[model samples]
Target: TVPGIGPVYTAGIVAEIGDISRFKNHNALAKFAGLTWRQHQSSKFSAEDIPLTRSGNYYLRYYLIEAA
Candidate 1:
């Protein structure tokens, strides 16, 4: 198990992410957990303080954040 995460959180995360094979990699898993930063770019400008996309499985995100 993870250092800070307990059994319940681990189970919740696993349950929310039914099939691990569906994701291509860790990045894909992060995206599914809504833990990725949003893109903020234009013609020649890119914002430095972009927020999270906040899209995807809500329960997974909640479990991950709480565990952290």
Candidate 2:
């Protein structure tokens, strides 16, 4: 078994994402779970990116955060 992942957390993540290989990379995985932050920009200057996107699976996000 992987370190730091107990049964419940592992089960929850697996249940949410059936096939991990479907994601091309970590960014894809994060996007699927809605854990990526939004890119903010104005006319001439790009704003500081600080907020997470509202979209994504809340359950998966919660589990991922908990695992971290």
Give the winner by lDDT. 1
Indicate the residue-level lDDT of 31 in model 1.
95
User: What TM-score would you give candidate 2 relative to the actual structure?
Assistant: 0.81
lDDT of 1 by residue, 1-68 (tens): 57989889989999999989999999999998999998889999999998889898999999999988
lDDT of each: 0.93, 0.87
- The 10-residue segment with the lowest total lDDT in model 1: 1-10
Displacement of residue 57 (Cα, Å) in model 1 is: 0.5
**Can you tell me which runs of candidate 1 are displaced by over 4 Å?**
none
Scored by TM-score, the top model is 1
Error of 2 at 59 (Å): 1.1
